[model samples]
Target: MQIPEFSKEQSALLARFLAEQKDALSLAQTHGYLFAVICAPEPLDVHQWLEQVVPGCDGQMDEQVLFAFMALYQQISEHVFETGYSLPVSLQFNSAQQPYLDMQECQHWSQGFMLGAQGYIAKLLAAPQLASELKEALETAQQSLCFFILDSADIASIANQHGLTEGLLCQQQYEVMNEFAAGFAELIEAVAVNSQLYNDEGWG
Candidate 1:
């Protein structure tokens, strides 16, 4: 089925609306959250995830605004289903005139993704019947994404686990962005292939 794409103007409007919302996820964060929702082993309810994306949206959202947000959600979900992990990460030029991802934007995006993924990932990994190799793959993928989202202490821990010194990870932020995108693709592929196995009673 061909879905209408969320145009740049609509995205701008959504960003403006979100800015007016108290504690609402930023546009980048919303995109990240939607991406995670699509990759989840089981789907999350639209209303529930909408609430997460825009706190108190159900109680007070304007109808047009709500419709636009829902369209945004549907577009991202469809993109993931069709294209796997095409991360909507923004890039900027460094001092040497080299292009690299905007780390701050990546951080916000990853933060949103982590929030959406936490419960689903925990449940997926905790399944007693899950295979060891797949489990390891998921853990690694999670860690790669976590590097951008975690607190200083947790980020340090991951860096240390990989035999890197403190703060060294930030030195290669662009490389980590590539790793994050690769990991997300891996996760989407893994979950897509094994989706039926995860569609248990409560999740359905």
Candidate 2:
């Protein structure tokens, strides 16, 4: 699937709107969470999912901004479902402008991802057919996601105590984010396998 690129101007516009609305997740994180949700075995309606993840979206944005937002979402959905990996939007940020991942923003992004996964998690957890290793991986990912929920000041303090620099902290965060993405991808693969089996044998 060909992913559409949003120009810098368009991104700035969307960022402005999200800022004005005091949205918890940044535009990039919003896209990331939406991508994960779309890659799930049982995906929700796009419009409904967007409405839940981004409240007041329809009412607050002008048509152009709204269209751009949906276009980005579609691009992310296509990339995740087709390739089983998230688009590397996180890498686009430069260390100069934003030296490190803000703890608060990371928390918001994790919260959004957790919210998006709520519908599918119960079924995933209850599936007796899932392998033990995969289940453990999923559980570990859940715990990692929760780590971001800690207070930014406290996290910073802990990092300072450990003598971690901004660059080192950013690298650690990326590693964790990569692990989370890999875990989700594994779960999605499991879902696909189960879905195929059910379709073949009518046993879902």
Say which candidate scores most in TM-score. Answer: 1
RMSD, every candidate, angstroms: 3.9, 4.7
Residues 64-141, candidate 1: write the lDDT tens digits.
Answer: 676677778777766655654455775567798766656667788778888888887887777666677877877777
Lowest lDDT block of 10, candidate 2: 194-203
Query: Quick one: how many clashes does candidate 2 have?
Result: 0
Candidate 2: deviation at residue 6, Å? 2.3
Q: Score candidate 2 by TM-score against the native.
A: 0.69
In model 1, residue pairs whose N, Cα or C atoms come closer than 3 Å (at least 3 residues apart or on different chains), thus clashing, are none
Candidate 2, 114-184: lDDT as tens digits: 77775566566667777777667666776665556667676677679889974576557667876677556
Q: After superposition, how far is residue 28 of candidate 1 from its true place, in Å?
A: 1.3
What TM-score, computed on C-alpha atoms, does each candidate reach?
Answer: 0.76, 0.69
The candidate maximizing lDDT is: 1
The superposed Cα distance between candidate 1 and the true structure at residue 127, in angstroms, equals 1.4
Cα-based lDDT for every prediction: 0.71, 0.63
